[model samples]
Target chain A: MELLGIANYLVLFLTIAGVYALLTLGLNVQWGYTGILNIGVAAFFAVGAYTSALLTAPATAQPPGPGLPVAVGMLAAMPVAGILALGIGLITLNLRSDYLAIASIGIAEIVRLFLKNEEWLTNGVRGMAGIPRPFAGVDIAGWSAGGALYLALTIAVIGVVFAALQILYRAPWGRALRAIRDREVAAEAMGKNVLWFRLQSFVLGSAVMGLAGAVHVHYAGFIGPEAIDPLFATFIVWVMLIAGGSGSNLGAIVGALAIWAVWSVTELLGQIPEEPITGFGALRVFLIGLLLQVILLLRPQGIVPEPRE
Target chain B: MVELAQLLIYGVVLGSIIALGAIGVSLTFGVLRFANFAHGDYMTVGAYLVLPFYAGLQLPVAAAVTLAIAGTALMAVLIDRLLFERMRNAGPLVLLVSSFGVGLMLRSAVQMAWGPRTLVYESGIQLPLLFGPLRIKPDHITIIIGAVLLVLAVHLLLTRTRMGKAMRAMSDSPELARVSGINTAQVILFTWVAGAALAATAGFFLALDTNLRADLGWHFLLPVFAAAILGGIGRPYGAIAGGYVIGIAQEFSTLVISATYKPAVAFAIMVAILILRPTGILRGN
Candidate 1:
């Protein structure tokens, strides 16, 4: 609770927000750029977290588990998450936009439920603990120093992702996606495989979410299915994208930071004493809900509004 | 045979609840022309609102039930007028997102009013009615009866009545209904009243079977959506049938899969239905 303590908290918050920024950017690429409402984004996130955690968290001399190095764990997470997304997209790609949204939500929920119940793989509700950090033996100065280090690493990853997305956005493939999004039939007439484009967007989005999750797991040093709850993925990320301006990468990053700031402050306020502040916890949540409602009603386009044609 | 009978009874009872839930979703989707993710949360609020009536006032069972249903209906209509109606003309995405906001607000409000714990409306209600190897409870019977009465009333209201016809016209084509001199706003209000009444009633009956929790309707929203889709979106009768199909499927999935993984069954069925035929089983459209 000291100033330094608050700084430490801020650093931790920024790191997590940066991770979400990555996740939201992945969503923006799918939803904003491609108009594909991928509601099951969290499934890949779970895959990544579970993958990294299960692999890196030293083998417990037990059966039915695959424990590997953290880097390798991160590597496995991307393909595993991507493949799942591809499978889901294959079945759902032909669906209308709204139905696609509903299906993805269902898929995310199913993945979460599986992770929560599949005790042999996920350790069930007890959750996996003791996930190791890279360079665990190194005297990382202090928790604040660790926070700074994590933030720097996240920033690096974000930079790389942004660069890659920049290239895609400028490429012919990206233009085709935009065409498909803006006018599916016209894009179809032009011989663009709309379904295939959608599937690719979905798989790529899921991969990005997985990478974010991999970073998040190592940072938080734990993994549980609850971490990828559909509500968190849909509601929170939706809010972030809207608050930022959906179609813009910068908007996603800014929105993630701003919303995460509000969330953090409200969460902290919820814990504050309530002599003159009765029901602060509930009030904080209420305010967040109110904030979202007000935003949607007054400015449906959002803060950094996505440019309209 | 007895086990099958029992399953059927349970399925019907569950179906009744599903019917009630789907009414809210279908009506909102049909009339409002947008997916209201918050619709389930309203059911959650309706159940929570029952706590004061049933538990606090300690009124007679029927009286408390009536009060709860009325209060929830009023709340739903007010929400429609104040919130949903404003966004009625917005694009689907805007409406969807706004409803999410509304749902979050309602959920937080409930969590604020009543903490994140489950409660029951204290009752001296007895055990299941034994019929051979099968057993069913008074709550189940009440749910079936109540849901049937409500649905029949809605059916009558929608078809036999002038207002009902207007609603149907509106659903078929809102602008045409308005041009035809139907009071579009009034029909919308009526739809909310009817849909919310069904929802609150379902919430109450669901609370009877389980306990009242803030997340009750949300937990059921997926299966309820699956039911609505299975029934072909906006058809009430289809929804009723679909709900039963969903309920039975959900319960039976547990026999094949682990009980813990039973919830995933709803999504699997939903995906299969969508992939196989997006129009759904009933073919209302």
Candidate 2:
């Protein structure tokens, strides 16, 4: 029984880690290989989660879904987020990196406002519940096999994304992105369309972030404003990427696992009543901020530094 | 007509708060060559710093504010010395990311000390005095007066004072200023002091208007950035004008849109600016 409990916990941990790993990988495509500082990660995240939740959730759910297949909802989330990126990228990609960062923050805020105010579509702040999982009802050997099956699904998706991104990382397209990042003037001199390439990267990465959100909403069985807060959905992703080494795909995956573990542990620690833990949430933030600062200052290469080739 | 007038008044008052915040942001952006993301939290820190003096120790408002400004200035210097100063060579994006971390740290620290719940310095109902067709709160009047005085003082310091001139020189050309015998480090220190002091005042005024929460300054960050960018990056005078433009537009926008989407108004304006004139109205680099 203890072993089964431990196994269930492991399944939960890895499933969530896989979702974060997906987000980190997407971020790498933009910030890592392409050098696009997309600070509005939470916007794309919310877009993806809400799109899927609204599409796949049953009509009985608040903000009633069309009750589509889970696979269709997940697939549709990518383009919805991509379109958002396309619109924002058309305007913001031409600016300097810092300006892009601030503008991204604007987009995130706008998305948050949309989710909070568009109650008819999103069920307002109460968020839609009863989001069904793919294999949520399967049981075998007098025990539910749904947990293991979902974990399998998450791992499978991560595997596909990881493999595809790895190939892209080494292709000519990836080299062009690196060129644009390293020296935009030189890339322009070499006849590369800098703005177009950047927009493509931004859209692609954001689409992936949307997928991560879709996966997340399904596991949590709901979506809400809190799920999309920039501090959590966005800032933590940045921390994971930088902590994992930005330019490397494998590093992105490793970083997600490590950072998410630490975050989960911190939450567990916060629940202790006798530990003199006042404002545990704040302390965790302070710790992560300090961690990011220390890494940036000292070992910016991260635990799994980007591979040369 | 009355509603229009009231909105205009609200715009100017809000604009004053943002202008104060943007002045600090513009100065630092110009001199440091990076958008300090921790700037909003500097306002938060400065505001909370005053709470102990004004509310806890029961010091007079003026004295408490002075101490808070000094304390905030000192804290900014300390952060720069400890974290930012070392990353001087790390480039702007690195610095910007570091400021994000600094902002989280500052805000979380505030939460740890003050708790995450919202608090108001004065919870009593503030009755607005009728000024013909417009109703004006006394606090609004005080904020406007204080902001105008501060803005005038800043304008004088920038145009007249040697330190201010040196800072401007550095902003225009850091290397050239350095080679031309300007003490770039000293100017940087002065920039933080000016920015943090104004941010302190902005925070206090913001709290006067709304209750204090851990995320109060962060909530204002969008409009503050909008004002700074609209004014033109690194132009203090432009920032002052931009603040009013953004503030008033945001307030007036509530006529058509829900008030919760006020930040969206600023975001729309900022996007328009980015697409139409990336250099901002003043066209400063």
Per-residue lDDT, model 2, residue A17, is: 91
Report, in order, each candidate's fnat. 0.54, 0.88
- Tens digit per residue, CA lDDT, model 2, B1-285: 999999999999999999999999999999999899999999998888889998899999999999999999999999999999999897888899889889989999999999978988867899999989789999999999999999999999999999999989988999999999998889999999999999999999998888788888987888888889999989998889989999999999999989999998888999989888988889866
Clash tally, candidates in order: 0, 0
User: Which pairs in model 2 have colliding backbones?
Assistant: none
Per-residue lDDT over B1-285 for candidate 1, one digit per residue giving the tens place of the 0 to 100 score: 666677778778877888789877887777767767777887887777778876788778778777877887898888777777777676676667677667767777887788777777775667778867778887888888988898888888888999888878887788888899999889888888878777887888888888888778877788788888888877777787788888887776665788776667778888888878887877634
- For candidate 2, the TM-score of chain A alone versus the native chain A is 0.96
What DockQ does model 1 achieve? Answer: 0.59
- Estimate TM-scores for all models: 0.93, 0.98
After superposition, candidate 1 runs with Cα above 4 Å error: A1-4, A60-67, A140-144, A227-230, A274-279, A307-309, B123-125
10 residues in a row with least lDDT, candidate 2 chain B = B115-124
